[model samples]
Target: MQTFRTEIENPVVEKDIIDLANKIELFHKGKIDEEKFRSLRLARGVYGQRQEGVQMIRIKLPYGKVKSNQLRRVSDVSDEYSRGRLHITTRQDIQIHYVDLNRTPELWAELEKDDVTLREACGNTVRNITASELAGIDINEPFDVSPYADAMFRFFLRNPICQEMGRKFKVSFSSSDDDTGLSYMHDLGFIAKIENGVRGFKVMIGGGLGSQPREADVLYDFIPTDKIIPTMEGVVRVFDRYGERKSRAKARMKFLIKDVGLDAFIELVEAEQNAIELKTVAIDADVYPVSKPVSVEAPQVAIKDQKAFELWKSTNLIPQKQDGYVAIGIKVLLGDFYTDKARLLADLVEKYAAGEIRLSLRQNIVIPFVKEDLVPFFYTELEKLGLVEVGYNKAVDITACPGTDTCNLGIASSTGIADELERVLKAEYPQYLTKDDLVIKISGCMNACGQHNMANIGFQGMSVRTPDKLVAPALQVLLGGENLKNGKGAFADKVVKVPSKRGPEALRRILNDFEANANGKTFYEYYQVTGERYFYDLLNDLQDVTNLTQDDFIDWGTNEEYVKEIGVGECAGVVIDLIATLFFESEEKIENATVSFDNKVYSSAIYHAYSSMVNSAKALLIAENKSTNTHAGIISQFDELFVESGKINLGVSFSELIYQINKNAPTEAFASKYIESANLFLDKVRTYRSPKPLKGAK
Candidate 1:
């Protein structure tokens, strides 16, 4: 494992991998707490899969961009460390499953060799920053948003502020008003816009998709591109300080905004502006690498089936602004593909195109900068690799998560039913192959990893019980959701819950009604006109569980009887209440603060120091059996119990001492003073707890 130290050139990355290796050893030796270890490993992108004793490594790709060499490197790592299979996530990340936990550091080091990383790919950190897959080449875009998305990813990769928040924060960049990046459902969403001849973005805040979906509120009609980074910083700072920490369900930014009005949330965000490191971060789009199409003669090829080729071309070709060039969309069924196809696709794009591919949010692949004349050649090559699926971003192209296949929180077989639905569409509703208006998404549970709640037609995996007390796999059918461009959207209404075995029949019924009565309107319009009650009545017959067959007891992708076994999810990482662990973590936060101070990142250093003080106070509060839920609550309680009560002397209220973070500018003097204050505070808390040994003190 030490060999990676020599191979990795970047010292920071090298230290990260070494730290992960050391932590794993400590965890195995029972030195690190299990919950603490889970948080640490998750922040490093190592996730626990549904299968016991295995891990899922999510490789972060900013804005879904992947160079040919990077793709090849990832494929090699997957082949070496995993089972030669890669799963594309809805966030545009690549996940390889069934990996031994001990080999993760080496696997991560291998990925970083090609400038690919697994850091901040999971856990409470900022997950992958996704963007429009057609960002650079979209004809409708005002300007390429790829550079802005890249800047955001770079600025926050290892930044101290969002490392371990109460829950994860999501960000997205839409290329245009089309909202292809799905801005309406992200925590912070940016849509590229040009107002008054200046490049900027339409900013949205506090939107999210889950069991409870909320549309993002408009923060700004347009803000200059220079303000995006600083604005995001302020938002993250506010969320960290005031967001929920005790209730995992209420930890998302949306809930905070919902609890407090958006106006008040905006006020809090504005309050942090003075403490922000940079008021404006200018992003030079000119420095972003430009993709150039290969200038070679098109290879002559004979089309085996002309009609099939035409249908594929009609559905899969993406129009580019550049003349004589088009991008190809490969509709990856269920988001699962093997490394053999990946490596070959990498080679194909590298030789004939711009040596790059973008992973779509819908878990598909887009090869941009391909010459129009080479479509047939590329089609033939892709056909050999089984990559030429005819329904790219169409009705038949369903998006689903790895439900029951890999995710611990998956309640039903999302992939199995997605497979069956695609087959049904191909056989019965061939016209849907080119129908791009409808979207069908499935999630094994209500977490909406599949974005099921925001699709035109959605299905949520669940279990239903019969009159005889027998449980069977079931799906909740939802209808009428639509993404109405420019940060506006609607969530689907749950119409009915039917047996999983009857899912195909439910789809058939919906499509049959739509085709007969839609009157050439789009799916959204048709759904709006018909209403949820109409769909409920239409699919009500399938909801009957009285005459259940043996097949109803079986889930889609399995042979055994359905036994619902959902494991604890590691989505936001677990909360650790161990007093010793909290104290230990406080020390670690101080160390991080010192490192950030040495690096001259005063804002980050100050936040790290603030976290240390808060953590230390929380430790003492826990010793007193107090509820340390939100940071604000911790500060108030610590002041009441320790400062006012005279248990620990700080000369002032804990709130006044800790609230200096937002009150003062993050200058060197304040950061140095804050670090000293944190150290002093930790010392006082330790001395206070030393004589009175905590009940479960290690």
Candidate 2:
């Protein structure tokens, strides 16, 4: 383990890995609180799997861009640390399961060698910043959004402001109006737009997909590219200050914007402008290194089946803006691929294409910069690796999460049923291999990890009881959702709940009805016309649980009777308010303030000091069982309970003391005063809490 510490070049990253190792040791020795430890590990990208005792490591890949060297490195790490399998996530992250908890530090250290990271890949921090897979090469895009996405990802990788917000915040960059990145469902979404000969983006804020989906509101019709980073900073600061924290279910930015009108939220965001670190952080769109295809003569290869080759070429190849080059889409089954094929693919890309790959939002892979003339050679090589699948984003292509396979929140086997559905689609509807309009997604639960709520046809894992008091696996069938292009989309409507075994039948009935009476209209168009009630009436009989047989008791991909068990979900943001932890955090914040002050970042220093005071007050408030839902709430509550009640003397209202941060300009004098004030405030809170006995004090 010390060897890993010595191997890391960056001292900060080395410290992070060492700290994680120490924390894991403490946790294993029963020297740390389990819940608190879970939060620490989760923020580092180590997640608890459903199988227990093993971990799922999420490798953060910014905007799904992976160079061949990085892919080879990841494949090597996966083979050494876990099984030789990598699962691409809906957020364009790569995850490896069944990893020993102790090896995570080494695993993360190994990834850093290739400039890949696992930091902020999970937990309450900003997750991987995703963008359209074809961001750089999209012909319709106003400009490439890859560099902007990369800049944001870099800015917030270890930024303290969003390290522990009310909940996780998701951001996305769409290449064009097509919204291929699914901007409508993210917390903050940016669509590329050119306004008045300037590179800008159509900004959307406060949208999210979960148990409750909310469409984002238009924050700005267009904002200059230089301003997006600063605007995002203000939005995050506002959410951290005013967003919900007590109730995990309602803690997202969407709920906050919904509760307080978007106008009020905008006002709060605007108020954060003065405190932002950078007013205009410029990202040169060309920062993303352009790659040229390796010069390789077209290899002579014979197509075994001409019709199969034609089908694959027509459906899987996407034309790139670059003349004479094409992007090949590989339909990854359930986003799972083995290390053997991965290394081979990496070799293929490095030898012939641009030495890189883009993981699609559809949980597939796109190999760009492949010459059209070399398509036959590439296809033959891919065929050997089993990477030549016909359906890229077609009807036969389905998106699903790990579900009961690994995720703790999984209620049913999403992968199992997705496998079955894909099987049925290939076997029964061969024509769908080229049909790209329909989307079918599955989630083991309502978390929408599979984006089920935004799919043309969706299935949510659930359970139902029979008349005999026997519980069986079930799925809530949803329909009529699609991306309407240009940042607009619809959420699916739950039409019926049926046994898991009957999911195929429900799909059969829906497709049969659609084909018979659709009158040449698209799936979404027909769904919009017929409405939810019509679909419900058609599939209503399948919801009957009384007619279940013995097989219904068993879930798909299992040989034994189904037992519904859901573990604690890690996506719920965590907070700790132990007196010691609070004091420790305040000290760390003071150190951060000092560092910022030394670096001449007065605004950052002032905010860090302000956060320290709020954290110290929050410690006392939690001691008194006061609500700490938001930073604003904490300030007011601290004033009401501590200052006014004379329990702790600050000589003035806590609000007045802390609110000075916003009232005064951030200067050398204010930074000094604020740092002193935060120090005194933390000391006072500690003194007041020292004599009091807390119920769960460790």
Candidate 3:
């Protein structure tokens, strides 16, 4: 592990890697529990793959922005530590697979040399902060959201409050009313808006897609940019304290808002105001770095296929707000590209275009700041890399998850079927090459990693069994999903389930029917007119399993017999409410509070101290085998079980002591007093939990 220490410049990041290395050793020595160890590794972005003895390292890229050097660093790391393949995710993260768990620390250390990180990329902590790839150049955007998104990622990277939350939280920033960021499906969605010459965002909270999809409700129509960070901090605090903790399925922020009602949830967030460090922290948007293309004369290149060049140019080039500049969309097939192509692409962008690339939410790449006259030159250069395919963000550009390829949660082959469907579109529906209205996304499971439920046509991987007990890979066809635009949208409805082998046939029938009968209507508009039942009935015959074939028993991309095996997903860390662990965490919180106090961040210090007290009380409550689902519940129960019942006295009630955080100003005086109160309360609770001696004991 010391081998990486000399390579990493940031001491803080170096310590994180060292800590993970030490924990892994401790876990191997049987000093740490599997659940706790799993959480630790996951927060560092080391995920267990479907196959045993390897890991998937998710490299976090804020808003999908990667410098040319950073891209080369990742490629080098991939070549050194794992396979040469890089997989871009729907959240704008890059994942490299089939890595040995023991070498992750070294792998991370190498990536950090170029200022790239994997922290909080795969865990319950705020998963990669995603935004529109066209953010800085979008003609419809009021202001660039890149800086604000960066601020959020930096603020919460290792914040004490969200280190071990019940579920993962996702945040996205839409560049414009186009809602290209898909604001409707994130835990907290921010759409860029300017009102009265003031920059702000239209906030949407609690929207998510899973086994049960829920659309987020409008939180604020327009909130000033300065308030976004503070608002998010308060909201996360409320969630950490009151969000569901027992059942994994109900642990998402979406479920919490649903159970308590959005109004009540907002009230809780408002109550956390006094505990936030900065009330209106303004993000310095000007400091946000954006790369400009090198001013180079375009080199003439001969185009062998003029027809193909025009087709590619027509669909792949997006107009930029900057004059004489355009953004080129490279439709990365299934978001997979090798290290060789990666290094070449990095060099090409650095020489002619911007020295940076934005990974799109649709699992593609956008090279912004390309000069309009250099389109042909770029096409020829990219053609050498086999990246000049047409129909980027069009019907041919299908978004898909790894599915059975690697993801532990995948039940069927999403990538395999996605390849087939894309082939079908290119071969049969060539007319769709110029159409951008249709969206297709796929996921291996109900987790919606592929953003399936947000597409015009979606497919979810599943399994179906014949009467003879033979199981075959299947797909849950979802329809009628619409982007809706302007911070509003609808999730797709599950219309039908068909054998994986017939997935192409299902797409063909759906498209054929839509084209022949819709009379130029968009997919979503036609779906509304025809309704869910109408489509369900149209594809109902494909659901029959009685007439099974040998091919149906085998999953796509595999020649072996299909076997349904799903390992546990480490997307959300497990609940580890061990009494000793809780007490240990309380002390850690106190230490953090003291550190914050020294830094003069009084509000943060106060909140940390308050958390120490709550956790201490919760430790005692757990010792008594009492339920501690939410922090609000824990406070009420602590008072009832100890203070109110006169078992332990601290002059005043626990409610008054804990509630002081919200009632008083976040001054140095109040913060110090509150921390003292927390320390005293913890001492009392510690004594109470100490094993008492019997009469006439030694």
Candidate 4:
């Protein structure tokens, strides 16, 4: 029941924030304060991200769709609170940033005025439930899952069980293979298909987000729509009872399914589903009222401008499963809006567009029902609003998480890096897009806030050093990640670890490599055929440095690693931040961190509870003989975290340590000291955060 303005990262000036939340709880007497509880909703995020001045606010819009008024309110919140920027996420939710700490309560109040809610936006809560954007309009839809998504959203909002679930639960629904929703990578993905002449959902269990993503296992071949609620209750109950509670790393439903087999997990879900009372199912579609239409004039098309209309035709519209209607794709750069512009957009869509508008997963708004004739006029009005940019599906559109700016869990300025990279790419290498879709995604931390693990070429911002001896935030290129419905998680293969400034050029170089080797196919298909090795060799040719002279890096993995991976697809890249950080000056080097050619070093928060991937990345490989007992308190403190790169194995061979030492010229304690200091540095990071793009990265 924390207020919208109050978060773990916000400076708790008075106990008022805490007292207020407790008061809210009392008022509810356990039930959600359906009306005045707007401020108490948004609980999404890890703590490390918000220590910086920047704030991330997630809005819950069920079924990946929203109304014109709701959309306007989102834009108003952006203009009023944030720096007029929104990041449309892979999840259907909208995340706004650059919010002032004091103004957050006001922002929440404003959102409530428009009937918008930020509840269930973060934390271990059931995040905004999502369904295919075309749910209501798509004729192929088995049964509109919008109601189900709506039902779940209403059923769980502020429900204590889901509000503090062991882990975040992402639910997505799609109809058939024209899957706009990435059903495979969700905690629960429901795809509509016909079985036995009955349209029903193929329930999928345990899929999720990460570098180690798992596709959901089928829980039911086809669960009828009526059974959907009961089925979901079963799954939640299973997670509630058996999901790993102690280890955050093992808390996601995917881990539970992986540990106890999908079959057994389904059995648990079935047991729970069987217990739900259908007669008392908690839902009133009329009360929750999703989206309805208003009459509008037929759209007007300008016949005078063929070229403008042609561009509009190419990027503005998408095929609706319905023959008479089409869905318009309105490109939203960084998903931002002004209050006036929001109002105008809403009016424009309401007057000329079919009353329905949807918020796309790409962080853009969609006008679902624009007529064929009004194409040109809509384009003109849209241009007047300055929202007619046609580069969204292209590289100019890069989704980013609000890094160090506001979230307590952030490690770097994810959005800042993404914005810079996207700008550089659009100006420097626009041709890369003409070659084919080169999705460049960026995240602030290992929490995968930006969904970097799902893009074709993703970048997670981290502080890294260059060969020239300077520390700054940089991006690590991930290759070949996509949602494969057949089977397999998207893989973001490890490629080049470069300074953020060089990301654009590196992106261009990689695309050029893809073009030269692509033969004649999409970049993805080419990478699929050529393999990671081909891309690695190309990167080897472009490598700017060959050696490091300091003890600042904690290098992990074998010497012959994939310097740059090709198209190895989802959940690739061995977590090597620790090993990468330890390669510096023997005596003065920073420990548990890596130094680049520029003398910049990278290390993670030692006490970063949310960072399991980076904490013990090197420890998992080095043998017990080489391992120093890290936690030797009066009480036994077994290192609960182990970060092993699936690509590298740390065998019991101290002899192999010889191979690792750039040269064993110094005692191992020399390396150990740096690691110890780095750990302390990490511990301190949790308390302090630089504003997003605040000072220099170093």
The best candidate by lDDT is 1
The alpha-carbon RMSD values of the candidates against the true structure, listed in the order shown, are 1.6, 2.0, 2.7, 17.3
Q: Pick the candidate with the highest TM-score.
A: 1
> Tens digits of per-residue lDDT for model 3 on 265-360?
999898888767578998888887766779999999999999999989999999999999999999999999999999999999999998999999
- Tens-place lDDT per residue, model 4, 373-482, is 56667778877888877664666677776555454545456665666676776677766433325676777666676778778888776556556754554567778877
RMSD of 3: 2.7
Q: Give the range where candidate 2 is weakest over 10 consecutive residues by summed lDDT.
A: 689-698
* lDDT of every predicted structure (CA atoms): 0.92, 0.89, 0.89, 0.56
Q: Which sections of candidate 1 miss by over 4 Å?
A: 1-6, 692-698
Q: Over the stretch 1-698, how does candidate 2's per-residue lDDT look in tens digits?
A: 23346398898788888889988887888766787788888899999989878999999999999999999999999999999999999999999999999999999989999999999898888999999999888888888888899989988877777877888999999999999988888899999999889999998988888889988899989999999988998898888888888888999999999999999888888887776656799888775677778888999999999999999999999989988899999999999999999999999999999999999898999999999999999999999999998999999999999998898898888999999999998999888888998899999999999999999999999999998899999999999888987789899999999999999999999988988999989899999899999999999999999899999988988888998999898975477657667767788889889988998878778878988998888888887887788999999988888889899888989988988876677788989999999989887887788856333332
Candidate 1 per-residue C-alpha lDDT over 22-140 given as tens digits, one digit per residue, 9 for 90 to 100: 88988898878888899999999999999999999999999999999999999999999999999999999999999999999999988888999999999998999999999989999
User: How do the predictions measure up, each by TM-score?
Assistant: 0.98, 0.97, 0.96, 0.68
Which parts of model 4 have CA positions greater than 4 angstroms off? 1-55, 75-87, 98-110, 279-305, 420-438, 466-470, 486-489, 541-698
- What residue runs in model 2 are displaced by over 4 Å at the alpha carbon? 1-4, 599-604, 664-669, 691-698
- CA lDDT, candidate 4, residue 506: 71
